[model samples]
Target: MKILLTGITGQIGWELQRTLMTVGEVIPVRRNEMDLTQPNSISGTIQQVKPDLIVNPAAYTAVDKAESEPELAMAINGIAPGIMAESAKKVGAALIHYSTDYVFDGANTTPYTESDKPNPQNIYGKTKLVGEQAIASSGVPHLILRTSWVYGLRGKNFLLTMQKLAQEREEIKVVADQIGAPTWSRVIAETTAQILSQARHHVSDFLVSKGGLYHLTASGQTSWYTFAQAIFAHDVQHSERKLQNLIAITSKEYPTAAKRPAYSLLISQKLSNTFGLFLPDWQKTLELVLSE
Candidate 1:
């Protein structure tokens, strides 16, 4: 099977490139090779590759920056997936795209499910939601997996940021109100690979039957303050730590250009029930990544 994987440099894409290799011949494409913001680039790449599966983990992910760059963000995060879906349809290929928990406004106390109505509070969330809608309407065989709080040893994510700040500052303040799983990139990648592996010889038919939206995330949830505490506690390189305190503050304490969901924890029950794949708890995954 031939698979066209995008965002080779991203956190999730970096890991997906490695894991997906076990299932098929992986053709990893960088941004320069297949820019999502360009419709011709997206369509032309798919047409050239003619892959059986097109796994796209690429998007405009800057939360706060997206407020000022709405057009650019919409082009990538909102319009790109629809174009990819259309392209995939022409080639009779299945698509797997990653989405976010930010599609919700974080109003509910319980974890957000796939059936929940999305009320995005910020530009990033709004754009991601639009992408989800596009893929669903394209009539293409696809799986829109919604994950949250993604981090890996390599990307510009909360995990790396906390580790960097731990060594540079004595006192670091984090928002305690926002809650969600701190999913490791490897877990997401591996789980996705496992699910696709089951499709095997009948990839498109499988996706057509089980395709749609599903929440894929770590088992447990935590706030940014607590997540940072875990990072420090499980730091393999403890010698690099600074002196003082890890302060917990509300979202208002540290305002940003975009308003984030106060509680965006996603329920992975649908994913598990459908694929029989479950990601480990956020804490366990964090420890494993740090240990490695």
Candidate 2:
């Protein structure tokens, strides 16, 4: 099977390159080759590749910066996926797209499900929700996997930021109120591979039966403050740590351009029920990532 994978340079995409090789003939597309910001580039690339499966992990992910550049963010995150889906439909291909938990308002105490009505609180979340909707409405066989607090060894994420701050600063203040699961990128990629590999018949047929919106994230939930503490505890370079104090603060303590959800924990039971797959707890995934 031919699989066209976008965002090859991203953390999840990088891991996907390793995990998806066994599933199909992977065609990795970098940003320059298939920029999500350009609609023609998106449709053009899909038309050219014409793969059986199009896995898109690329998006304009700067949450705060997206407030300032809503147009660019919307162009990439909102408009591109629809074009990709339309193009995929033209070529008889299925799509696997990644979304975020921010699609919800974080107003609920319980974990979010696939059927939950999304009320995005910020521009980034709003755009991602638009992307998910576009794919769903485009009549393309697709899977919209919503995840939260994604971090990996490579890329600018919470884990690397904490490690860098630990080395430079004596004290670190993380948001204590906001809650979500800290999912490793490799887990997302590996799970995607598993989903595709589990295809009993044709790839498109598999997606037709199982494709829809599903939450895929690490098993457990924690606040940013607790997650930072866990990171410090399991950090491989513990000896180089200069962090003496890890302070817990409210969302108001450190204001941002975007309004983040206070509680955005997504329930992955649908994914588990459909695919019989489950991700490790956040703590265990963190340990595995740090060890690697």
Candidate 3:
């Protein structure tokens, strides 16, 4: 069982390299190796690799900048997955793709389920939704894992940004209105390995039966301000950084070019029901990541 893993340099992909080795031979594809913007490049690389499974975690992740580079975002986030799915299908392989919670507008007061209607508010979200729809329409055996508020030690994420700010500045302000789970990238990788283990043990029917969309995220939800405060309180206080305070502000006060969901909490019951797996709370994962 050879696995073609994209975005190996990314936070999740970095951890996946360690975890997926237990499952099968893992092939990491860096950007220069296979550019996602080039549709021909994707198909050529997948055909050459001929992996039994294709796991894509790469994307045009610049949320605010995506508004300016709509075409680039569409090519990477929208069209590229479709090409990969087509390639995977031709090789009789399954595709495990990661998606974002931003697919929905911040309107629902409750946690979003797989059945919820997606009404993306930003170009980034719209393009991601396009990719999701295209993969499902292609009728390939796939696992569309929709996660939210992802962070890791080695990436451009909220936790790293807050840690840098706490070290340099005495105090920092963060948006509190936004609510979602802050999932650690390591947890996502570990869980994916578990899912793949079970799928591999079973026949192809296992993936075909369970190969729809599912929410994979931390158990609990939180706001950006609280999440930042926890990160600071955990390690910053002990270090010489000496961070003073964290100010909680509304989303309107701290605006961005790309509109974000105020409440994009995703319920992971579907993932648990199918795979019998669940992640720790957002706060707990933060502490665990900091501890290591």
**Candidate number achieving the greatest lDDT relative to the actual structure:** 2
The residue pairs that clash in candidate 2, if any, are none
Task: Judge candidate 3 against the unseen true structure and give its global Cα lDDT, from 0 to 1.
Answer: 0.89
RMSD of each: 0.8, 0.9, 1.2
How high a TM-score does candidate 1 get? Answer: 0.99
Q: lDDT tens string, model 2, 160-276? A: 999999999999999999999999999999999999999843789999988898999999899999999999888879789898999999999999999999999999999999999
Candidate 3 segments exceeding 4 Å error: 201-204
- Weakest lDDT window of 10 consecutive positions for candidate 1: 235-244
What's the TM-score of every candidate structure? 0.99, 0.98, 0.97
Instruction: Mark the regions of model 1 whose C-alpha exceeds 4 Å error after superposition.
Output: none
In order of listing, the candidates' clash counts read 0, 0, 0
* lDDT, model 1, position 250: 97
How would you encode candidate 1's per-residue C-alpha lDDT over 1-292 as one tens digit per residue? 8999999899999999899999999999888999888899999999999999999999899999999999999999999999999999999999999999999999999998899999999999999999999999999999999999999899799989998988898999999999999889999999989999899877899999988899999998899999999998888878888838999999999999999999999999999899988779999999999999
- Which model is ahead, 2 or 3, in terms of lDDT? 2
- Candidates arranged by lDDT, highest first: 2, 1, 3
Model 2's lDDT to the true fold? 0.93
